[model samples]
Target: FEEINDELIYKKDFDIDTIKYAILSKLNPKYLGLSPEVIILEL
Candidate 1:
């Protein structure tokens, strides 16, 4: 997982849901170009 910058957390209008979505989106199989099964196997 990627780390969010401290600057982003300190933003005045930051929303928890938005940050969660951003992190979840990166975990999508299409983004990593790997199948879910392969990901689980590696883990």
Candidate 2:
């Protein structure tokens, strides 16, 4: 996201929890007007 410079990663594993958290972080924030595009910076 260019607007806020959003960043995320999965260091060891790409499990459900990691994906869930990433989605929630982007979608559940109140300040943001719309859901941010989820990004995986590294694996």
Candidate 3:
């Protein structure tokens, strides 16, 4: 993800949706059950 951030910063515009999808797709299943409060705090 750091690599992605560095590459995106080099480019003009960053696609936030792509980053969100990438994070969601790669997150561990154990983390998928986080409560809304935890999720908000993590974000």
Candidate 4:
């Protein structure tokens, strides 16, 4: 993949862990096998 023009989309000024936890909590039970830490790392 080639790099396209990058843009600042959404901006967050909150804590990283709090944001990750919030996202993880909203996930479906089927995704329980995926570690929340892994998800954050892959983000």
Q: Which candidate leads the pack in TM-score?
A: 4
Candidate 4: stretches off by over 4 Å: 1-12, 37-43
Per-residue CA lDDT of candidate 3, range 1-43, in tens? 2356457434436566665666677767675765412232223
lDDT of 1 by residue, 1-43 (tens): 3338644444547666676557667775566633232221213
- Per-model TM values vs. the true structure: 0.36, 0.33, 0.37, 0.41
Q: Rank the candidates by lDDT, best first.
A: 4, 2, 3, 1
TM-score of 4: 0.41
Error of 2 at 20 (Å): 0.2
Give the winner by lDDT: 4
Candidate 3 lDDT for residue 34: 57
TM-score of 2: 0.33
Off by over 4 Å in 3: 1-9, 34-43
Residue 41's lDDT in candidate 2: 64
Query: For all candidates, what are the clash counts?
Result: 0, 0, 0, 0
RMSD of each: 9.7, 11.2, 6.8, 7.3
The regions of model 1 sitting more than 4 angstroms off are: 1-12, 29-43
Task: Report the Cα lDDT for residue 39, model 4.
Answer: 45
Model 3 is weakest, by summed lDDT over 10 consecutive residues, at 34-43
Between prediction 3 and prediction 4, the one with superior lDDT is 4
State in Å the error of residue 38, model 4.
Answer: 6.3
**Which ranking of candidates, highest TM-score first?**
4, 3, 1, 2
| C-alpha local distance difference test of each model | 0.50, 0.59, 0.53, 0.65
Candidate 1 deviation (Cα RMSD) = 9.7
